[model samples]
Target: MKYLLRYQLINYLRTYKYVPPFSIFILIMVVNYTFVPNPILNSYSFTSIMLFFLMGWFTITLFHAEDEGQKIITILHSKGQSAYYGSLFIVCIAIGFCLSMVSVIYPILIGAFGEQPRVLHIIMGFLSHFSLAVLAIALSAIFTRELVKNRQNTWWGVLSILIIAVAIVTLKSVILPVKGLIWLFPPLHLALEMMSSDDSLKNIPYVFYWQFAWIVIYSMLLIGLYFFILHHKRKL
Candidate 1:
């Protein structure tokens, strides 16, 4: 597993697949913090959402860094398909968390926020960034060559899922009657909304805990579905 992870990292770096999305994400942060005194939670809300899409894009790129032949070779050497997929996911998760830290911590370190951030604010910022980031990865994991078959369609499918999943909060508000249907998609918006709460350091919101639980369960389901499709539908 360690060797496989090393190989994935080397391959990902060699392909430079991480460049586009990561570069854009960094550029966005630079531009966003160019002028200081930004609102802490509001700034976090914007970056977390941006990180969601960028990380989804990064996941697709990272997962597909190895070509078909290389993946088959790696699969044969590894324990099984699960190990292979798991390593890819671990790598993506590691990358996501690293970037999440950058998004969450960079502004804080630079003191970009107009108001002094409390412990709750920092914790919520990191949590919001991480929850949405990993959800994006899980969402993108399914729409790959091993499952989606059509290369072009995989791009569109991943993009569509990310866009719709993030936008569902707005959609849910508009279509109040059918909001329950969002259980089918990742609840990324909830993470951003969680940050919007008017909670003080003395009192944390229950919704924060509830939404995190939902994100964890939802991400696990998506990952399970990805592996299930690989086991049942991938060519041997």
Candidate 2:
């Protein structure tokens, strides 16, 4: 597992430095800085949006890499699918945390010269953002397999729109007594709790459950794909 993590982390780090993803991340930060002044709100929304983008990039890049060369997949099969899948999931979560932290620090540093810093709140804010970002990434990974190919970004674009629509609907519907329905949409609830004034952390359990569900489903799908590829396709 450690070897698999190291291989994936190093491979992604090497490509991340050169890809348009970094430029896109910078542009996201710039937009947040220009418009979203409150660090608390900015961090949550910025991280959510950036995660959506990065998830798509990660999925496409992984597929493109696989299609272009067999070295990584060959190594993956050698190292064992369990380790490979675990490492991929861990690496994606780590990336989410790193990106959320970067976004959080930017506004905190700028606000330091004037505003009173609520360090605990800020930390919680980043945690919330990181949680949602990872959840979104997991969802994206599940939705972007060959079953739903990129097709000129059509898959991602549609998913993005659908996610926004569901969030909006869920946000409005959560006002009633149907709080149970909120668990179905992890990112929306996380973003709401982070942005709202409540600090009791009442929603953490639901977020964890939903995110865990996503991770389980994603891992299963990937594992199934690995086996299907090896057994039938003989080379994915």
Candidate 3:
């Protein structure tokens, strides 16, 4: 597993697919610092949106890397599907954590943010952003794997426009309870509520506990489904 992870990480570094997302993250930070007196506030406000897209793109690219003929051949010769998926999962989580730290740690380091620094707030923000990125990657992996199984190419442009439109249109509506459906997506619920509140630390325990639990549940579910798909496809 370690060797496979190292090989995959080196491949990602060589391909430069990770560059665009990190570049965008840096750009967002620069713009936030330039225009906003409170860069941390801007980062907190935008982290959900930024990470949603960035991690999605990153996951898509990583999954597609397997589609190349040479890479597929390498995977077959290695420890096979288990090692491949495990290594990919580790890489995705690492990328998510690194990208999330830009929003969490950079703000604290600069000391130009909103309220006086609270340890609880920082911890909660970091966990929430990281979990959100993981969720995005998990969803992307499922989508990519299904596309591969069905022998269909991704239409990223169309999917991007649709996602943006739905997010914008439902941003406010998602807050309102619709038959308790809001609880179904814990990450989105927590992110929206957290970003909306000026005093996020007040209810930190409740939000943090639920978000953490949901992230674990969601990730396991998606990953399990991904392997199930792979198994079924192999049988066919």
Models 1 onward score TM values of: 0.94, 0.66, 0.83
Looking at model 2, which ten-residue stretch has the lowest summed lDDT? 197-206
lDDT for every model? 0.84, 0.55, 0.67
Ranking by TM-score: 1, 3, 2
Among all windows of 10 consecutive residues in model 3, the one with the lowest summed lDDT is: 149-158
lDDT of 3 by residue, 148-199 (tens): 5442445454255427433633564765556755444434555545555554
Per-prediction tally of clashes: 0, 0, 0
lDDT of 2 by residue, 114-176 (tens): 344465556556755565555555555545443355565646653774377336645564544
| Superposed model 3: Cα runs more than 4 Å off | 39-42, 149-153, 157-186, 200-203
lDDT of 1 by residue, 1-236 (tens): 89989988998999987888878998999999999888888898989889988988888888888889988898999988899889999998898789888988899889898877888888888888888888988988888777788989989999999988867877776655675766765787678677776534555677788888789789988899888777777556
Clashing pairs in 2: none
Candidate number of the best lDDT:
1
For every candidate structure, what is the RMSD over all alpha carbons to the true structure, in angstroms? 1.8, 5.4, 3.3
